[model samples]
Target: MSVLYHAVRTPVRWAFRLLTDLRVEGLHHVPSGGPFLLLPNHQSILDPLLIQSICPRKIHSMTKSTQFTQPAFRVVLAGLGAFPVRRYRVDPQTVRVLLRLLDEGQGVCVYPEGERSWDGALQPFRRGTLRVALRAGVPIIPVGISGTYDLMPRWLKRPRPGAPVSLRFGEPMCLGAIRDRSTRDRRLPEFERQLVREISRLASVPISRETRERLDAGSASPSGEGGS
Candidate 1:
């Protein structure tokens, strides 16, 4: 890890540990050193800080392109292992950066849900996010994060003090060759379910029927997954 990364993670982890009743499990599932994709469900704004800071490995994650508008923030985010992705558009440069980082044996994390859920339920993943996993030559780790939504949901601007939170990492999932995008689309619901089941179990969150229905709808529709 870079000195800058260490410098930031230490204090963030410290503050979180002090302020929140945090529980972390399945550390063994995280590769001690290697290129692996980390798929975490987005919960709170604190999710990234919680996952990356508590994680033993250095994790490079995607931040919104707008977050990098400020020059100082851009430098800070880059040092903290973040790159900007234009969420609403196809950004090839983001994919190049992701692939390049993985090629260098760095751990990369992307929230499968494009953004944090409003009601603590797992939201539908944006098209192109999962497709990245298909292209990467690495194992994918599904992470379940609970309680951050309770700490601070979309309705609240500030976190509640002394809320409990948990992070659970599951075993690796490796996908074989997908015949084509159409074939992949046919199998998309299963793939989404795989993540939902693993993450929800790991975090002890119940999979909602509505969430299942959304994935079902997604399977029949043509969509894209990229980290391409």
Candidate 2:
């Protein structure tokens, strides 16, 4: 499945690169072996596609369960190595499936923010991601994406031509450093906070401390929470 995904992705990546002046940094940080998590800041719907394009490893992506309601869409998602995840609900079944994929040494891509940002700003990391990462005992690689929202914002039907996009792959974070059975619940929040901070540091555009605080506060609420 991964082999097929790579074959189909090559040309698509080139096309995106041609259309958008896409740039990537810190590719060397991705581990060559073992299970790992690619946790990126969600700016637009295109963010996931962009990450899949540049990553050398084939990533198992999680999509909204609603998208799978359509048979055709479900087939396409399955072919692309994506699985359905219920939004705003902690699905243990989905977590177990992801853990199995990790155990097989496959890479998984997750948006720690849980959803795309309406304003192209970084949002708070969701605890669900932290739960999976810690449970699977996989390293979390922080990724930062910039300018995708301008290209294809929620209000737009199609992407604007010639928009700039940048992706930065931060250093891989060791799960061992964050693991603590005694304070597992508390650790997720702190881990997510640190993850967002790392992503913000790598973004092409700078984010203000005040804005980060606002995003974190907003994410604490149930509303506007996105699927995996």
Winning candidate number (lDDT): 1
- Per-residue accuracy of model 1 over 1-228 as CA lDDT, tens digit each: 899999989999998889989898888999998789899887888888888898899999988888899999999999989898988778888888988998899899988777778778776665577666766658889999998988988788999969898888899887854647777676666777788778778767665566777866665256644541
lDDT of 1: 0.81
What are the lDDT figures for the candidates, one per model? Answer: 0.81, 0.74
Candidate 1 has what TM-score?
0.90
* TM-score computed on alpha carbons, candidate 2: 0.86
Query: How well is each residue in 16-79 modelled by candidate 2, as lDDT tens digits?
Result: 8899988889988888888888888777777767877788878788777887998997887787
Candidate 2 Cα lDDT to native: 0.74
TM per candidate: 0.90, 0.86
| Candidate 1 least-lDDT 10 residues | 219-228
Every candidate's CA RMSD:
2.2, 3.7
Clashes of 1: 4
